[model samples]
Target: MNTPADRATRVQDIVTVFLLSITAVLTAWCGFESSKWGGEMSIAFSQASSARVQAAAAAGEARDARQFDLQIYTQWVVATADEREQLAAYVEDRFPERLKVAFDAWVDGGMAEDSPLVVDAYVAPGDAEAADLTARADGKFQEALENNQRGDNYSLLTVMFALVLFLGAMSQRDITRWVSRTLLGLGVVVALVGIGLLTTFPIKI
Candidate 1:
């Protein structure tokens, strides 16, 4: 014949088993999510690095193009000041399409206020592309930081679930009934809190 104490002990054992099992699964899930978010962060960082390199390359190209255009414009200016029409025409013919547009606009404006280099139409090659690539790199860097924070959040939940597992295992000891029940109750409370926090995190996989 099972006494009331035996029945209560049996019930406590069942609840402890259930709590341990559920908390173990939740712990594993948190670890998995943390790993996934870490991978995402690495990938985002790599993409940001690649974009930064490309942006730097584009900026270098723009600088070189601008310098070449300046050299050509200086030659043209010297030829024009010396009244060498043929030399000026020769240098003007060699102007890149980008510089030619600005030069034509400057000439049309009576060459009064600003030089071709300062003209609105004087966009060096790769300038816009470099600016766009830089913006993309900045965005990717921000995304990487966000991913890292998400991974950290999941890691914290994993630690919380581990504490719950510890408490649930301790409840199975040969302690007094009330003490065992208290440990089990604490474990359940911790597990519930961890689950609530888990719900708020973004899922990566």
Candidate 2:
């Protein structure tokens, strides 16, 4: 009862179903990984920025406060020295510890990020090394941002592929048309859920 065109259509429909299934699964997995990766990248940058700010604040407070007098301001000088040491430890140790894992993860995934080592930033101020590290961090943040965007795109494509497959699988009859439309609607809803996650999940560095 089937013509050549009908047979070809049926074969194409089968292929569509397989492609859609594969794409849908991949999209879901990729989207989840992207979200988690972006969040970790953002946290790393934020902690670095905080460490930098704390160091600068300590330096500025030491410079402005009186340190020559030992009568009443001796406590201030001691506090300033303590603050400087704390700042050094934070930049050289704490920040690096926080970012080491995320940086390694990115690199192992065949992507690289700015080093979190704060040796130059703390040991030698106003140098090229500090500038380079900051610039590298910004680049890494942008890379993570792009990855998140790519995830959204892939998810949308998967939904479109699913709709095409559903339509191809349906007959031209009224009941089949209704079923196809329902499936397409569900696809759209799932895709929108993905979009919501893409926007809401924190990626800001």
RMSD, each candidate, Å? Answer: 1.7, 16.9
lDDT values of the candidates?
0.93, 0.49
- Tens digits of per-residue lDDT for model 2 on 52-171? 565555555443322211212234335446787664444434323324344345446554333212222222222334455556556655665665565456455545545544543453
Model 2 residue runs over 4 Å out of place are: 61-205
Q: Candidate 1 — what's its lDDT?
A: 0.93
Residue 124 alpha-carbon offset, candidate 1, angstroms = 1.5
lDDT of 2 at 22: 56
TM-score for each model: 0.92, 0.37
lDDT of 1 by residue, 72-168 (tens): 9999999999999999999999999999999998889888745898888789888999999999999999999999999999999999999998999
lDDT over C-alpha atoms for residue 191 of model 2: 52
Q: By TM-score, who's the top model here?
A: 1
Q: What are the clash counts of all predictions, listed in order? A: 0, 0
**Model 2 C-alpha lDDT versus the unseen true structure:** 0.49
